[model samples]
Target: MSTENGTIGSQGEVNGDVMLTHFRKKDDDDANGEVETEETQVYIENYKDKLLIYGINDSPPIHVTIICALQQGLLSLSGQLIVSLLVAEAVCASKNDAFKARLLSSTLFMSGITTFCMNIFGIRLPLFQGAASEYVIPLLLMADTDQTFCTSEPSKEGGQSPVPATTTMSPNFTNSSLGNYTNNDEITMDRIIYNVQMIQGSLVLAGFVHALLGFTGLIGVMLRFVGPLTIVPTLTLIFIFIVGPVIKFVEVNWGIAFSTIAVAVILFLYLAKYNMPVPVWTPSLGFRIIRYPLHQVFAILISIVLNWLLCGVLTYAGLLTDDKKNIGYNARTDARIQIVRDNPWLTFPYPGQFGPFGFSGAAFISCMIATLISVLDSIGDYYACARVCRVPAPPKHAVNRGIMIEGLCSMLSGAVGCGHATSTYGGNIGAIGVTKVASRHVFIATGVIYILFGIFGKFSALFISIPYPVLGGAIVVMFGIFFGVVISNLEVTNMSSPRNIAIFGLSIFIGLAVPTWAKKHKSPVQTGHAMFDKIMSMLVGNPNLVGTIIACFLDNTVPGTAEERGIAAWQVSEEDERADVDRTEFNEGYEVYDPLIPRSIMYSKLMKYIPFLPYKRGNVEKELGNVKTS
Candidate 1:
């Protein structure tokens, strides 16, 4: 044991492994220098082992930044497009090619705006914000409850509704035909518009509550009970529940889908280590050969491009038939080619662009629940991003600020009628790990690229034209990675403990089983009030939210040590554990997340009162002393 000032640090053996314990001297005169045993466990992983080519603060050359930005932009665009397409199908707007194209553009626009604002004023991490897949669950539930939309679902028997046959196949398809909406088309458009409005209003309300949670520091208090067991089941169930839809998409063209999957797997796994030489010209060095991890960095983008090209070739060669009734007709690249010509050359997404906002009690409740889940996911992503970037976990204030920014951004997404909330893209975080470039500049540049593409309507429409099977294949790999990342949370937990195993297994199994049951037996939650019935049904039907609730309840109530529950590592309090950590190291980590303001202003005493600012010299000293005496 060693004592410095009033702080005490000691090491002891527990189950043959060393455990660190901290204590502080008591101020009471009941005994002679009696000390209180706080027993605050510290689990500091060696983040320095994983070095980066361009760190969080480093700014690469302009050319290099643009190249990296483009790669990240493509990944972000693909993710946003997938979620938008899913939302379109859920709201029965898949047949409205024009509206679907606009929705995709709106999603991209909001993602870009949020990504830019976040890196500049929020977490200051290299996290790319995009449409969250978790919101799809609630939308699916809403669609099921809607009588008009769910009355005769053709997509259920077949796959997603293909582009209308009336849409011209010409490269310059006129907008005159697009504007000729029949009575039936008008009704469908009204329903789609109404559904999007409901989503918008609900997201706006949820974002306000979400922002309040962060601003008031309530999220920090809630974090006390969140652990790996709670997080693992909650996040893993998200991908697990979406398997049916992914399968439906892949079934559109099994051959094309599997080929896309094979290409992704080969590039991401088998050829990850192979480096390709690129010739570059610079004023300092006229020409030079730079070995780049091309396969690793551009794996997903390359796979999509290659498969898309193959699909086009097959379509042109008459191998892929264009019959509307054909099984694999939607696999052809030209299936939705009219979308590109129908969309304007330039466009802007503004609030209430999709008619006035509307609210539904059931939708609001479901969105609120999804907002909470998104918060938890973002917190976990922050930690993972930090670890991957070779930095200490973010401090409390930085995390609170991040959540607040996400809430505000979600509101923007809703206002713009994106029909989905924005959240940190886990795939991009993994990309950071692979590419060894976590520069905020790269992310900011990527955000600019997103904004640019979003403004150019034709570009967004071009991407929206990707074949369903190709996207399905990519979604499979993406969601699979997501599931794997969620499960990786178990690394810090004592998995051997039956207590932990039982909690996770029961939570996931019941979570999945109950949702399946609810789907089969519709109207399982028929309360006296119609609104209440809708709310209950939607809540009960969401596998992620259900699993999260179960995991949190069991994890908190069940008796288990901190180590077994994984809370020891998950709940790292910067304020409470400051005495045990090196002062310089702690400050350095905090600085990484500090705002772009001058240090003097950011660390000012006034900033201490703000819940989201990193004020280093405020009540920290007093809190530490109080903690010692208490």
Candidate 2:
């Protein structure tokens, strides 16, 4: 055991010295002031402190970091593959199989590059960047619109076809329209290219808007208005929105879905507390024993493998039929097996591969809202990652840089024609919490792995073919926990206060209410202008965006004390004059610009006021000193 500052840490000495129980924060205790019985000491002493490993840039053993990175990278890739599949299913249903595979590859490629850039230059945390779920709604909207547009055209009857038709014949001299019958390959390519171009346009526009916000540091100003009330409903509504899609997929094969949920719950929750003793062979220390939480580390991966095995077994026994004609059986089978065969073994993502970019004002407007949603989601993730990593909450500049990188990479996503934007992956934050390994180097390695794996089209297709039921089952657990994490932030607020209660209840109600209403009445927000109407409709339809905007407005304007609204604890600012010094000293996750570089520019007398740079020592000290005296 050891003590650092005021915090206590202990290694697990579980077998003999179990009396040295796991330490819990006072806040974790019940009214009786007793710790939970499930937690106990294991092997390492001061495990939390020792597990700190390398603080951001402090180099650890190459092998160790590599292992950690590979694990995290693979998990991140798996999650993105699922997301890519979802996006493709929604937007590319009428396009060629190869086109969908290309979209998946492009998303993977862009995600890897974006993650690497952000880790190196942005927030520099261990957060994994991938396809944002918030953008899925907009993509689906575009797909639906495209479908309707095609159907409305008199020339194209039966607008929905998975694959284009092929026919070969000599042009009949008697028929003038015979010349217009193009080959199936050209028709398929044209449809795929057109869709990609439109999505690319929206992504580019949204990225530019987000980058501008981050660059001007305008997003930081908005953060002050966001309190726990704003976060809780917004986050919960996000999960609620996500659950609709999961239910749609899972409902296809309830038996497979239920089985998946059962296995996942057993592995992730039931076996979470059980640790297995394993022998560790260290070169210098010889063979020693350690108790490891193998279940926590491999819960998702194991659950998936178990479900896959069950699927295979059931199919072989004829209990679960494998029929392309049946949606239920298709949900459980590797129905996308053709994607692997169609795409090359190895292919790199090239910008404009789908053809020239095309712009749509309505699509751009929808994407703008999605970008705003991503911004809000990323902010919550920033705080979550910091908390799990045992670091102080991010200051304004760090948050700004993170968003800036997100925007910049979003542009790259468009350039690569991924048809979706990139943002921090909530799944990876969960992974860090489970493994308790918060090394930025590991994420850096993960980024490299993503880039490498993305080049292999077959690998992307392999994961893409994972049963939809399995994916839905994982989403149930993941989104459920996501909702819980957001709600848990309420602990800082005075939940019993009627004023707080009203705000929370109203925010959630409006969030759910608006989306439900918008869906039932499509043109609810119609202004004569089509683009403006589309934008408002999209915003109203998204529960997270609506709830967040309403909650932020109420929390900032409503008559309530800072304590009642949870702002005081949620945004814990120090009155110390060394605020600038504290940021420099505490940021172990990623190196912000060197202290010397900012100091060199400080002679201009206006550098500290800038949004991208770190706080100015002189100005911060002056303001903080005045506050201290007051």
lDDT of 1 by residue, 415-484 (tens): 8888888999877877676566788999999888889778998887787778888888877776566556
For each candidate in turn, the TM-score is: 0.80, 0.77
Q: What global local distance difference test value does model 2 have?
A: 0.66
Candidate 2: Cα lDDT at 471: 68
Each candidate: what lDDT? 0.74, 0.66
Best-performing candidate as measured by TM-score: 1
Clashes of 1: 0
Candidate 1 — which residues are off by over 4 angstroms?
1-51, 89-92, 146-188, 575-588, 618-630
How does candidate 1 fare on TM-score? 0.80
Over the stretch 1-630, how does candidate 2's per-residue lDDT look in tens digits?
A: 433322344444322212134454344447765644433333453232233334555454577678667656655554576567667655443344444556677888888898898888788777789888878776676555443433311233435233221221112211122122223434433344445566787888899888878889987787767777887776677777666667766776777777866875676567666665657776645687766555555565666678877777766678765767777775654566777777678877766555456676767876887898788888878877766665666666677888988998998888777878899887677656555567778888778877876798777667666677766676565555555556666877899988788888998899889888988875768679865666667667778777888888888887888778776654533233234445433534223322225343643457557675565455545655675798
